[model samples]
Target: MELKDVDLNLLLVFHQLLMERRVSVVAEKLGLSQPAVSNALKRLRLLLGDELFQRTSKGMEPTPYANQLAEPIAYALSTIHSSLNDKQSFDPLTSNRKFTLGVTDIGEIYFLPRLMVLLATVAPNVTISSVRNTAVNLRDEMETGHVDLAIGLLPQLKAGFFQRRLFHQQYVCMFRAGHALDKAEMTVDEFCAADHVVVVAAGTGHADMDATIERKGIKRKVKLTVPHYVAVGHIIGSTDMITSVPERFARACVQPFKLRYVPHPVVRTPIDINVFWHAKYHRDPGNQWLRSLIFEHFSDQADAAA
Candidate 1:
């Protein structure tokens, strides 16, 4: 059992087989005959000393050993492929390219701080700028290549873009640290009775949340209104106001703004935060590196889906 005894090409075949399951599908994807794929799987079985994959009505399914090897093997293959096929061979340490990302204001608050910190050490020359995803021209900008990537709950970009799920975040009720609503649990009436600072963020498409709440006949008292989430923290922290926000935003703002949060009394669907890029730059090395960095650092489902 040695690296010399294994054909690295078989790993690529192994990777594709794990993805497609059927030998014919794997052969078609890899531009080989079905027999070639079957032979590669046979070699993989002998080299690894495991059955690897078994055929069933569900198509080819990985054995326990194959499942055990999947993560490390996929990661290794991706790293090797990126290393070999990097267009212009991007070097993060030396590349001075600037990348602009489209994100909402809350996106900026949650994504940029740690990103900048990481760049300062590993990619000091690289620069990042974030623009509001609410911009009317965001889609055109991304298509025409002005915006390199986008991250947030962007339902607008789902149609014609490549996306990877980073995590799913739930809504939380946020208020000042010492506010009365800080209790472990509160009733719908208690939540609705509190003075609220409402944020009418455009393009976030949260009307469904309102519709759901309305259907439940639960309504909150509105004490103030704002156009965005940036000021929600400061306004609620200083006043006896409460608002429902994404869990990460609440977590990020809680300690710094001296705020506290409890799970929303009303059950709400969690939003998926994803990293999106246009197909035009899908193979661009710098784009790939940046996307990988974000997905690696911010994705909560990395083990499950990465």
Candidate 2:
């Protein structure tokens, strides 16, 4: 409990252990020997007066005390590291910083191209890597600094986070440019009778469009399902099957994929897209700069407001 009684280095080990759970895995990740990691754990246990982890068939499982300590300890370590490394101001033009973003498939299709062009001119040395984003693990990933920013729809970010509205999107049906429905006004019956290609975002096997259709007691004749929106264009552009996608993403895919978009027959509220970051990194200069860059290039406040 006393700062002097605790070896600050143990916190780093503890944080790694919290993530890896198994001592051997933690040791490998931290570049420490197994015995060293074990010794650190022993010392941490004595300092905190708790059996921080319990060995089980499922590897090392955190005790309730360790679970309670994980977030705050991770945040504290992250803050310390950021404060020590951050320069007076972030010079994006010259800094060689790599940022990891958690972005949905649709977002990646729509935003990454534009962002990369802007970064190329303004921050040539900076780089970006994007991973699939999900609401389930977003909070923990952000809290632990595993993901720098999560850009997409994240209704799960209820607290301890800050978000900015990037844009609002509505669904529209897309098909090959010369498909039978190309210029015809699509009726509800025609929309339901046509074979459809559905996009299951992030391979989750669920679609909001399907849910909305089900709510309206409308069953779509789904012919194929693909995991990413990027593939939807290809599958739909070459076949009679149509897929509904976010309007902006559909528009972007139109020319390259030789597809045409029509208003979706379903009447549903538009989905809100937002960029989220943890409160811990809210003011970090590097994070602030990257966030601002994204906002400036991608955010559509006028459409979002409307």
Candidate 3:
């Protein structure tokens, strides 16, 4: 079929239908009637010479041909939208934009609350979707646009990536208030002897703290290992376990859980927390605006430290 035979607007309709999978919902979103959407779908099917969608109990399921066309079509649409955005200055106050951010569980603890509060005043219509930064699959996700911005200790991203350091973080040992260590001068021996609640990493399911300490010839008696930092507060609060966490996160938990942090018994290496994005989106107006806002909100140390 020729380009003259198909309306480009139908591709927009097709893309939205692919996303929503229901004609009625797509119509509502596109401000068209359901019949109009159906007619557009029929045109799409005829132009492509394929039944792009097949109706089933689970809404409209895309055919294999549709699946094959999905990525390039979406990329084209995104390019067009971004091109349009390039013609105007990004006005955060007037734009309704949704951004996906990949953050470590610790980052979510320390940053999300404050960031949301700031956005409420500066860009009320903007929305955020946060994803876990598991170290693994982050590069792929960012390159594919599944993740727009990632904030974490990602030293492994070396090429085709852009990054700016938010802060340098050191470790601190935390325990519930009134714990035995709080009353005594804490030593390495005492810290290692105590039962520990460690956060296993999101991707590997292994606690990196264990390896970091082991390299220094120290071993803690780990009684519990969890997959996220959010659970550490309640676990440490109710139990006799201690955890070593980033200073920022440890400080944030102190007030709410009646926790106290001391210097890490073993000398720990400071990790760089960075904001990373794919090079493909380097010049995107929306991405650039969001990156600037995030850096302004979180970082004060140095320029492009990572």
Go through the candidates in order and give the clash count of each: 0, 0, 0
Off by over 4 Å in 2: 1-87, 202-206, 302-306
TM-score of 3: 0.67
TM-score-based ranking: 1, 2, 3
* Worst window of 10 by summed lDDT in candidate 3: 201-210
Q: Which portions of model 3 miss their true places by more than 4 Å? A: 1-88, 183-185, 202-208, 302-306
Residue 201 displacement in candidate 3 (angstroms): 0.8
Using TM-score as the measure, which candidate wins?
1
Listed in order, each prediction's TM-score against the native is 0.69, 0.68, 0.67
The C-alpha local distance difference test score for the whole of candidate 3 amounts to: 0.84
Q: How far does residue 62 in candidate 3 sit from its true spot (Å)?
A: 51
Q: Over the stretch 54-116, how does candidate 3's per-residue lDDT look in tens digits?
A: 999989999999999899999999998999886746678988989889988887899899889
lDDT accuracy of residue 87 in candidate 2? 68
Model 3: per-residue Cα lDDT at residue 181: 87
Q: What tens digits encode model 1's per-residue C-alpha lDDT throughout 137-250?
A: 777898888999999877888667899989888888899988888888767888888998877776775545556677888777888888888988899899998998889999
Clashing pairs in 1: none
- Ranking of all candidate structures by their lDDT, best first: 1, 3, 2
